[model samples]
Target: MKKYIIAGLLAWLPLAITVWVLRWVINLLESVFDVLVQGAAAILPLSTHDVLHQLVEIPGVGVAILLSLLLLTGIFVTNFVGQWSLRQWDALVSRIPIVKSIYTSVKQVSDTLFSSSGQAFREAVLVPYPHAGSLTIAFVTGRPSGTVAEHLDGEYVSLYVPTTPNPTSGFFLMMRRADVIPLAMSVDEALKYIISMGVVAPTAEGLASAPQTTRPAGL
Candidate 1:
C-alpha cells in the first residue's frame, strides 16, 4: 500500500508543481492588470474607464497587450530617433548617483550575457579548481579584462563556474588559457549536468576522456 502511494505521488508530483506555478504566475499578472484598471477608473472619463475595465477583465488579454507593447518598443528602438532617446535616457540615469551605479552594473552584465558578439557559455570546459587532481565544469565567458588582465599578463580566460541546482548565481574565475581543458560536449549538455547536480551527465564517449592541460610555468 505504501509503495503504491509513493509511486502515485511520484507520477503526479511534476504535473502538480507545473500547474501550480502556471496558476500562480497567471494570478500575479492578473493582479497587476486589476490594479491598473482601478487606477484608470479613478482618473479616466466614464466611457474610457468602462472600456479599460472590460478589457482588463478579459482572460489572457493583459499578457497579449504586454507582449504587443514590447514588440512595438523593439520596432521603435530600431530607428534613429529611438536610439537618440535611449541615449538621452541613459545620460539622465548616469547623472543620478546610486541609480547610475546599479543601472550601469546590471546593463554591462546583461549586454555581456545577451549580446550577439558575447560567447559566454558557448562551450564546455574543464578546469582544475580548488585543488589539483580534481576537475570541475566551467563555461567559457570570453577573455579577461581591466586590472585582471594586467595582473595575469593578458593570458587568462574568464570562466563562469556554475553551482549545482542553481546556475543563475555562480562564481567567476580567471585562469590561464592553458589551464582550461576544452571539452567536446555542447553547452546545453553541460548545463543539464549542472542543473541535475551531475546525476544527468552525458553518456557520450567524447565527454568521458580527460582533456590534457598545458599550464604556463609562471602561474
Candidate 2:
C-alpha cells in the first residue's frame, strides 16, 4: 500500500504544481486587464463601457492580448524606425533624476543577460568554494575589467555560485581561469540542477563531457 501511494504521488505532484503556477499567472494577467478596462470605461462613452467590462469578464482574453502585444512589440523593435524611436525613448528616460539611476541599472543588467551577443551566464562550470577541497556549480558571468583586473594576480574569470533551492541569491567570486572546470550542460539545465538541490541530475552525456580538473597550483 505504501509503495502504491508513493507511485501515485510521484505521478500527480508535477501536474499539480504546473497547474497551480498557470492559474496564478492567469489570475494576475486578468487583474491587470480588469484595471485597464476600468480606466478606459471612465473616459469612453457610457454605451461602450459595458462592452469593455464584458470583454474583461471573458476568460483567456488577457493572456491572448498580452501575448499578441509582446509579439507585435518584438516585430516592431526589429525595424529601423522602431530602433530610432527606442533610442529617443531611452534618451528621454536617462534625463530623469532619481528614476534614471534605477532604470539605467536595471536596463543594463537586462541587456547583458538577454542580449544575443552578450556572454554573461553563458557557461556552467565547477569551481572550488567555501574551502579548497569543496567544489560547487557556478556560471561564468564574465572577466573582471578596468581597475579590478589590475589587482588580480593572474588570468581570472568572474563566477556566480548559486545556492541550492534558490538560484536568485548567490556568491560572486573571481578565480583563475585555469582552475574552473567547464561543464557540458546548458545554463538552463544547470539552473534546474541547482534549484533541485542535486535531485535532478544532469544527463550522462553532460557528465561525460565535463573535463577533469586538478587543484590550482597554489592551492
- Taking all chains together, each candidate's TM-score versus the true structure is 0.79, 0.89
Tell me the tens digit of each residue's lDDT in model 1 across 1-219. Answer: 999999999899989999999999878877877787788789888879768978986899877766687799988977999989988998999999999999999988887887778886787888887676677889989897776677776378889999879988889998878787778888888988889898897868548534343533332
Where is model 1 more than 4 Å wrong at Cα?
24-47, 203-219
| Top-TM-score structure, candidate number | 2
Q: Model 1 clash pairs? A: none
- lDDT (Cα atoms) of all candidates against the true structure: 0.82, 0.88
Task: Provide backbone clash counts, one per model.
Answer: 0, 0
For candidate 1, give the lDDT of residue 32: 76
- Score residue 157 of candidate 2 by CA lDDT: 97
Best by lDDT: 2
lDDT of prediction 2: 0.88
